[model samples]
Target chain A: MRKTLLAAALVATSFGAQASAPGGSGCGWGNMLFEGSNGMPMHLLATLVNGTSGNRTFGITSGTNGCDTSGALSYNGENMLAQAGVMEEVAQDMAMGDGEALTALSVSMGIPAEERAHFKKTMHENFNTIFPSEDVTAEEVMGNIQTVMNKDKQLASLS
Target chain B: MKSINLALILVLASAPLWARATNEELAEHPRWKALLHINEGTTWRYQGRSYIDDPEFFLHESGATDARAELEASIEQLRPAESEARCDFPARYRFLSQQLDWPDDGALSHCSDYQEWREAMPEERVALIFPASYLNSPSSMFGHTLLRIDRGNDEDGVWLSRAINFGATVQGQENSILYIYRGLFGGYPGYFSNVPYMNKIRDYAHLENRDMWEYQLNLTQGEREWLLAHLWELEDIEFDYLFLDENCSFRLLELIHLARPDSTLMDDFRFAEVPANTVRSLDRAGFIESVDYRPSKANELDALVDRLSASEQDLALALARDASVAEEEAFQALAPRSRNLVARAAYAHLRLQNREGERSQEVAQRGLALLRVVNRTPTVPDIDPQRPVSPEKGHGTKMLAAGGGMLGDRGFGELQARFSYHDWLDNPEGYLNGAAIEAFNARIRRTEGDDLTLEQLDVVNIKSLAPRNRFRKPVSWFVNGGLDRRFIGSKRHLTRHVQGGPGLAWEMGPVIPYAYAMARAENNSAHDVLVSTAAGARAGVLWYAESFQLGLEAEGLYYHNDDRRYRPSATLNVPVGRNHALRARIERDGGPDRAETEFHLSWRYYFD
Candidate 1:
């Protein structure tokens, strides 16, 4: 009788803590509009709403973003969480998109350190361990260069 | 008086027979035999046609009829002129200068008895017939050389003589051709006269007359002249459809021996009965030209012609000409054709495809054709249509690893040069052999609760030995040699220096396969030289479709100073890309005082 009463009291406390968290709105994707320096408070609120989201995804604040359609995180941040098993399918989809985007980024910024590592790891996991790459072609490399140069120009225009 | 007359008659009767015997003896002399052989070998003969225009007329009487009367009448009625060209059996020729004349005139000249004119014709009249075509063509019979047949001897048969026939013609009248005029006074048979008549036509025009057989040997001037000098004495030489019909077996053999001594006469003649011993000698010598005065006459002329002409002679001639044109089309094709008979013979040996009877038959036919072309025209090179193909991609190397298993890290490197010329080239007249090399290393390391043991070993072999690399198994000083050096140092181990001895390798394929030996040396003590002999085999397959290479090789070595020790190993390798490779290798080794086994894997990146 005493154990049951204590469990009921613990659950009520957890519910009360969730209800008091920031953003009563649904996952608060609009909160991602806040600048990188803002440290989006929505992720903390969302982590409470979705109990399985881990610290790698929820505690990142504005440093990294997840690949969720909710637009609160970037592909890199999502892939990291996926690798950690916080989000498996979501991380894989983000990695595929990241591979396509990184091809362009590689030509512009010589490949982001995080993206290069993630892509290499993915290749190792899929193909024969003898090589990390098998389908590199001249056409694909040129396409990447064009996209990266275009992206750089757009960013420069804004600047 | 009666007795004296009878004795004189007896002496006269015996004189002619004695002379005949002496003549026969002279003809059989060894010097004559040599001369005859040379003469027979060089002369060119052809069975071309001679054009003879038959004019329907009788000669006029020289004295019975009034010459002035006939001269006036003949001059009024007849005009001299030439006719158009006519086709002969082999080529076109023309004749010129058929004319009429009268010596005396009388009122009854026109009424002169034709019988009297015929009776007087044996003395002074002759017919001059002119042909009408092929007047200025290069192939016309005006500029070539011709031989005249001499008249019959006291006997009915005619003995061939070194005689030049009538001269060739020059620029004649606007519409007239030249011809030899046979007059009644000349007393030459018209049939015999025609033969030399056409021959003289080409001779004076400075063109090469086809031999009596009407086939051009296609020889260079010097060779043609040499052959011509020999051809005259050769007897009973016959031809069908412009080729040396195999019927001239003995002569054909002689020709082959002269032109290509290294050729395998028997192998080429498998379709016929070429003597076993003769073929064996030819194979050993690597050329037919080296053999002289063999039993060539043992095979009759009839049998040879029967065999070579067994197939259509016309077809063979066409094929031979086609092959010649194909050969002349390229300079690269011309080199092998000019090589010595021995080299050609070795090439033929390599070409014999014993796998299928069909290929062997084809090779035999090509060999025969080559023999014939060389025999007739020794200076013209013969080309083999088959040439080995070169590989497009370079070599491959690889390394493999499986953690915590009986196998350790293994590394292997392979270089293969591959091609499909033998298989892909159409109707190839020959084949080419490929070459390759493989080097492998095996390493095994074991740690029992932190105490570590390590070993490294390697075996190297090559397909076509390169002059650059110095590390290999040199099994014999006279056969092979190599040198290698290595240094190793570890945090918990002492520095070690290792210098490997030379290694030996054997390659037995098309270019060079299973026919090599090598030995290497190492130092046992300060003053001792220890030697080791290793025997090994290596084979590889190149997947051009995937641009991948795989190889398997095994090698074993035994030390002379230490008989109890034997080292044996195997290696496998695969290529990853142009600059990278993966390898796997394993080895079982033993020594005089200890034994060890190891496996190794390696990933090699090459800068060049």
Candidate 2:
């Protein structure tokens, strides 16, 4: 009976990429942020123990910040979004003119701390041109950001 | 020539004895045992054998059981000038090198694979991350814990930090019952993986809407390196994954124990290693340096919507549903700040909703347009959601209670115990509000003139009451199955039952009201039928405050056998500090032929 109860308790306890091109799938941003096998039952079971199906990632493969280092756009030999797949976060922060993502992006871009406020202001002013459209690719956004940065006197040298 | 040969043979025979004498103490060290995952006992579950199931992890055939044999084999394996053992077991190499007189021949320096990997990691700091529970998803009801290897340098912030996660490797298309069965019985193999902190943030916060608590650990640089090296050893290693004991939290505590050899972080957890309880253990060990909170995307949206006026919130919802609403007079008439706030809220809404469906062009265009308005306006302050009490501060999971009550005309004494988790009446400081998840709850009662009998045994009970509002409409739900004692024809009979349903809930300040339509199946010994089915409805209102909680609920059921039952109950609970509480409940139960009134009072003590 104790064994049966233990089994019952156990049952209850259980119950509780690449940088090929800016617009390419390798760039990591081409896929939607929340795209995957998201069946409700799967989520319920997967989250029960916080388990994943066959994800065997070694720390070695996560280059820098798990971003594709082969991205076309390079800053200090590192792609801006290459270090972090936070394009949406960056976009939101860019609109607000300041955020953790925005600051991290600027730092990755080698922008000086003193020039960040100016960088934020410039990005804020050029938000429309940078974003252009809701479907704007991350590469296109980066290009537009560089174009805008090149126009600013203080930001031009950094860009 | 024979005498020289004999002398060489004698020397060779004595070398091992000499070596064994010196290395015996080192092999017996606790650190060595921890490295092998050898605990005291003979069984495979918790004691005796190594926790790691992978045979490749052990050098000696009996290495999993005999630490000395493994240690000696490791030494022999590492003696070669070109041996890759140093790279495979760098932590062991470091430990052994300190104790033995190994030649400093730069073998470790030439391992480019290990060198390049180490260089990629900062190894300067470590943090324990807890993604708070998401009640809507029952799997996340217990929450989860992982470790983050911080790069130390703030150039990219902690977003660039490496996250270490331990989880079971399961099949994607498996059935749910099989999944649960395998998870409970250690059928799946668990492995440790490393990814970027930002990716984890996206997974937990943005996708799942679970608030994250990051606790920076205070470990010496040496300890951090030891942990990192051991983590490398564990790469691709397999351990039989069990849902209760040898789980993610348990594995991480083992790593921490390896780092701080003197700390007893893994001692208390033998049966279960709940994530929140692990955090509390870390806090008690004084290993926590500081804590930071990251609000989920849904939480941020809630804060943004909360800052708006009623009319503005309505306008924001309209803008989210239709892009043309931005052209309206009411939206256009708002001040620039208000408009920016409204647009931001709408954009957040679209992003959150995108989690459910495929990305569509229409939603994208609307979100982009809203962002354009936000960008055009002057910058407003970022939305800041109020951080609730961290999980470590919450009451423990295991609970024990004792009380005396009256049933009909009989006086009774009751004792109850719960194996895990939060209930609605418990303190809600660190748990999800309106969420109740309990498992293995049992109650026994002794009536005035009767022997002690089992009153109830709840195998599993879960309730998620996410309140509906103007911006979000989350459904409330509950499911429970267990053995219950019922009064049938003047005698008590234990019945097995399961019931569940969906409902609606609303929050208004301190008060929350909810209603549910339920369906139930029961097997009672007194009933002639094999199984009985019932349909019912339940309604309740709860008032929560810092000092106490009050609830009033009523339920009625109609069975197919022409039996009917109604129960109305009121409960009050007052917390006494963090680990104790007092509760009182009064309910009247009406059946087809009899009615009984029950009053109960209990004092509950909680612990991990």
Candidate 3:
């Protein structure tokens, strides 16, 4: 019972914080760009659409440090998928870096112009928040979004 | 070489008087005096050219003869002038009689002839070669004769010679003695380590040069024998050679035969260093330093020689030193040491910047060569114990450890535990066991420490599982003991158990195989111990370069002695990191009469 209360308290605090944040007030373009679609960094959505985990995460059973960490997160299907996305992005960056080519994610959702403009500014802030180095610029993020589109077409052709 | 000889003449001129001393006169010289005083009345003999003795004549009242004093006077009767020149005439040998035997001087018949000794002995008796006159002649004096006049072959032989000083007299002595005093024994006198073969005059003689004098005395059977035996006793023998070389320096001209036995160095006077710069210079001038530390004009000559021998180590060493030969390209052609050196260098290069060189292939080849040499060095194995063990020529994995144990109260009751195996030894075997015992002490608080209750204890319980092979059945068992408790308190005493049961097992998969099983709890009676039957499956998967696994088992327990039991209990376990795991288990309690559900969450630790 005490553990349940602690978990409830954690969720309440996280939800309350999420609600007060700018775009986090609703599940619109604001939230989409401020925090990721699923309480993760915004860059991950575009990353996951093009990655593969296959048979790796099937037997995962525990998490060691926390949800964002992989140890026990292996069994956390959503987290595993999220990690697969990050791994693919890292692998692609490394592979391309070998050729001296740099790329980053780009995002686009059909929303109000004012909302979209706000979302863009919010995403810029979020990007800085996630990577203190601010290495992924707005232009790179746009490029990544375009890549996702290209990848979606490829996946569509395969289907 | 000519300049070297001139320089040597100057050194000899500097120390003009350290030559030879007769036993009696030498008794007064600082260094020689020490040797003569070792034992009293012990005569030292020198059989070669000259000899000297100390004499002191006393003039007393006429006709007054004290027998002892008279003998003393007679013994010291040689006149002062005569004793100064003849009494100290240098003998060719001066050692005591005990050191060494005089060998026949290289086929010379001096001792065998009984006839007049005719053969002209060489300057060096050991090498048996005569030295040129200029090399052995003393400065400012005539050459002299030295002879082994001893009638006996051993220590009993007597040697004799004459003094060759400026104004010495040799009136009636043999010409051989006269020849020695006037003709040869001149320069610096050399020392002989053995007893002299002959003595005719005084106890000391001067030589301007030792090398020159040694050259002359190194003649004659007896003289050479005595000198060679004593050459080791010469002070500062280790540094005597300057340009002592046979093929390279002229000083070695006389040492060709004087080298100490068992030495490979050229007479301790001449030799060359391996890999001398001379060869290095030649190799750069379009030549290869051959197997002998000498340069060869054609590389093909060495290549052909090496090709003929299945394993040519020498040619390999030569090629290794050839800077023009790229190690990467020539490694396969070199011998083991050269190859090891080059390979190690290359390995060091690759390790820079985290670079990975062709280590796998290079190491394999070098390892093979070392193995071959180890196996082939000797034809007989029984005597040579340093042989290498033959290499196995196949692939395989090794499993080295597998075991498990449990600790708990010994009473028959209820309990809990977990089982695990840290190392999966080989693919074939893995071990683990989990168990819990009951009838533990119940606690209450009171004045005297904490009150303890040793109630009527229940049975002790146990469960275990061990995987043996991929396709073979794994072992599993459960045990329980139920016996009355003997002691009771907050701190309970000894408890006992009596129980037994059947075990379950199953196996599957390839390469990385696994299995599971269940066992019965013997704490309860047969009816209450409704032997549990469970099936568990395990599978391994690689996740991002790391390996991970999961296991799930479900079973039901029914105690035969009692009917309160349940079915379809299950256990789920997942390992997330090294040595740690989380497990969730669900089981029925009591019996079928009134079974209750129980669920448990546990953390487990495994050690390597």
Candidate 4:
């Protein structure tokens, strides 16, 4: 039952996006999110669609604090998988935006010591913008992050 | 009409002021009920209960009195702009916003860090991976399933991806009996764990002598996203782990349902989710595209061992036994192929010994040294082994038999049925040949008196007759307990039989023959037996083909009443499509009832 509600929610959210878009409520959710012609901001709907469950609503089956908002720790496969030990676990942790992994990732990206924590905080705050979807690769994430860094002057200053 | 409508609207608006709907009323709300999966006996989504485990997360408003108030308060908290950013249930709010067509307020910001992580682990494709059963582990012998998130193409990249596994988190110090009892009765909680695909391969392929079958699924990007979202929600959540119903395979069915919401994958497996049956369900749903077989360490070791001559095998065994002496004498002088084969076998033997905990610390250290030397020069034997058939292609788990034939000059009809799962004589197309497990099997027959009597009823019978290979030396055995009608001194009586013993089975080309020396205990009114005990020896041979199956078994029993009996049975089966088959059987029992011979034929249909 809870499963269907979320599915229904997805359907409705897409529809709402369509309504407010240029077609003004006539368009469906798909059109509202993708048509670009709609005045509705794309990032808002995109982020809203993917990032909500991160909060405490982790669902009835899911316990609270389901989302890993922290940056990656050293255990989060900061290095390649050629090495053993926790490489496998790190693969999953890094994929989940684990705080340790995110922080480790920022440190690896050459973020200064002072700015690494802030960088991890920013990454946690804007995980959707950094990841966008499942298809987004590591390179794509880096590219989008550059854009995010370039567009936000504060982020640029930290870098 | 407008005035009446206005009055009704006013009443509805004022309804929440003081005379708010009771918790039950709130629970019955269509959306609320749907959200909680509340039915007639709705208490909690998860069957497991505890005081510390918050009921608010699972219980319906009707079940938890304060739930309605808490829910209402949480919903109201979303109204204010400041609180909107930290909305309690962002997912729920988004869902409700769309479900109610309410505009979603820009609240939860972009989880850029999560995106970065997801970007690192992009899921382009997905597959259901079943690590096919390993012998000796009854819990996993039927196998276990996991979801694999694919990154690159179907080739080398599969190992680099992550696998999501769901399994019961058994408590430490839980004995096997307690584990089985708890597992069967929902005493354990199942959790989802993730690890690299390579790690899974190392565990299944190298550590556990279990072959794996990966069924690549066809799912779109959107569907994959939904699956990921659902998996995220289930992370760290404990399901009332049931060995049968909400098992590992069953939980995966629910996860897959989220991907294709319209598909009813979970509906078919409400009672039990046999891993093989679940694979069939996924196949029926047109979700599986291709299947890849991952050979286990034992598989590879056996394949290499098969190509070796007796002398070569002896040499390999000797080297494994004492690497120091054998290496000095025979290891340095051998053909490259022989060298490769011997090295691989020795490595496998050492690893197996270490894994099974038969090797001492010093021996294991020496074995590791041997492995390092073996690894230094990677050798590939020329011979390749055939891959084991995938479980998805196996015959249906449920079987029903109904037919009529003659027994002891009496024209008697009989009906037999088995709910599950497999038998040695059953078709081995998709299952491991010679392995059989059947539960709740019954055969009923009608005599000339027109009275229907149960001829035989079996509760549980399991036999794993995987013929010992060079890699695995399994002691094939059988355990069966049931009631059967046996003849003694020209009279027939129902006898309850419980028998089990170790045996040996060999698979030689088209025929698989086996022999067993079992200790049988029988209880019957007619048999004035010593302590109601008996002993038995049995021998059987089976020749199975795609279109036809032939089996014969001869058994000799000595009862406590100083009675001797022998029964020789022969049977054949011709499959009718994938789910149906025609079977015929003939049995001659040399009892006091004049050495009677019985014949029967049955047309059976199988269902998922």
Best by TM-score: 2
Judge candidate 2 against the unseen true structure and give its global Cα lDDT, from 0 to 1. 0.75
Binned by DockQ into CAPRI classes (incorrect, acceptable, medium, high), candidate 2 is incorrect
List per-candidate RMSD values in Å: 43.3, 6.9, 43.2, 17.2
Ranking by lDDT: 2, 4, 1, 3
**Poorest 10 consecutive residues of model 4 chain B by lDDT?**
B34-43
Q: What TM value does chain A in model 4 reach? A: 0.38
Error of 3 at B27 (Å): 56
Highest-scoring model, DockQ: 2
Q: Model 2: per-residue lDDT, tens digit, B1-608?
A: 99999999999999856664377898877788878887644223757668876877988998887788999999999777667888898888888876675778776786787777887776888999988876465546567778998768654577657778776554334444665677767787777777767778877888778899999999999999889888878876788877666777777888888999788775553666678877888998989989999999899998998899999999998988886787889988989989888999988998887865467888778777777777766666856999989888998889999999999889999999998777887988888778887777899999999998999988777777889988888888887777877766456677777777888999898788999999877777677886678899999998898799888999998888878878999999999999999999999876867779999999999987
Of models 2 and 3, which has the larger TM-score? Answer: 2
Each prediction's DockQ against the real complex: 0.00, 0.21, 0.00, 0.02
How well does candidate 4 reproduce the true complex, by DockQ? Answer: 0.02
lDDT of prediction 3: 0.24
Q: Which digits, one per residue and each the tens of the lDDT, describe model 4 over residues B14-79?
A: 975545455456534443432332222212234322211334343234333343553455456544
* Chain B TM-score list for all models: 0.24, 0.94, 0.20, 0.82
- Model 3 - which docking category? incorrect
Off by over 4 Å in 1: A1-159, B1-516, B524-554, B591-594
Runs of candidate 4 exceeding 4 Å displacement: A1-159, B1-94, B97-107, B110-122, B136-141, B153-156, B169-187, B195-199, B267-269, B324-333, B372-378, B381-385, B469-471, B528-531, B592-594
- For candidate 4, write residues A11-102 as lDDT tens digits: 23322322222321221211111111212222122111210000011122211112222212112223322223223222222323332334
